[model samples]
Target: MIVIDPASAVPPFEQLRRQLIDDVSTGTLAPGTRLPTVRRLAEDLGLAPGTVARAYRELESAGIIETRGRNGTFVAPQGDAALREAQRAAASFVDQVRTLRIDPEQALALVHAALRSAPTAP
Candidate 1:
């Protein structure tokens, strides 16, 4: 369902990246969803393969998707209980911030301050 507007101010790769991220985050693309291969997606979108590859690389770097050699790319599974809990907490925080109409910069500032005040482990 991803659309790339040829006349958009945003770069095509970035458009793809944001859409895929949004899909994964919102569960539109559930975990284990197999993404189209870079070449296939590029062909479908009428973009260069490198463009799709770059988007895939960025998503993989962000832990949103994983590439398994020969098996293709798929949405990354929630790996551990603690990590899943943390993700849920983060989603809750985002919802709360949205409800409060907090700007991203202000919300990030709050997070930074909280992080600075938190005690570190040995």
Candidate 2:
């Protein structure tokens, strides 16, 4: 269920990367689930093989997935660690917002602003 938004400001590879992370984090792609080969997924998504490869490479680096040589790629058994951290942070934010009597929409807007202003890792 990967989707590429043509109108998005994010690069296609990044979009794919994030979607895969979300899938893995949410159990949409369960631990040990085999992933489609880079070539097959690129063909399915109408993307260059290199794009898919890059996404897979980053995923592997982040310990989200692993490549088993000829056996292909599979989700990591521990799921996404970064996603777990994000969930914890989100829960804390929700609690803080509730305590402060902020509207949910306002809290979401604040989060969006923070994300937009976030600096990239060096």
Question: Following a full C-alpha superposition, what root-mean-square deviation does model 1 have from the true structure?
Answer: 11.3
Clashes of each: 0, 0
Task: Give the TM-scores of the predictions, in the order they appear.
Answer: 0.65, 0.69
Q: Which stretches of model 2 miss by more than 4 angstroms?
A: 84-122
Candidate 1 per-residue C-alpha lDDT over 19-95 given as tens digits, one digit per residue, 9 for 90 to 100: 88777767888889999999999999999999999999987866778899999999988643234545766888999
Best by lDDT: 2
Residue 11 lDDT in candidate 1: 88
- The CA lDDT of each predicted structure is 0.84, 0.87
Q: List residue ranges in candidate 1 displaced over 4 A.
A: 79-122
Q: For model 2, where is the 10-residue window of minimal lDDT?
A: 79-88
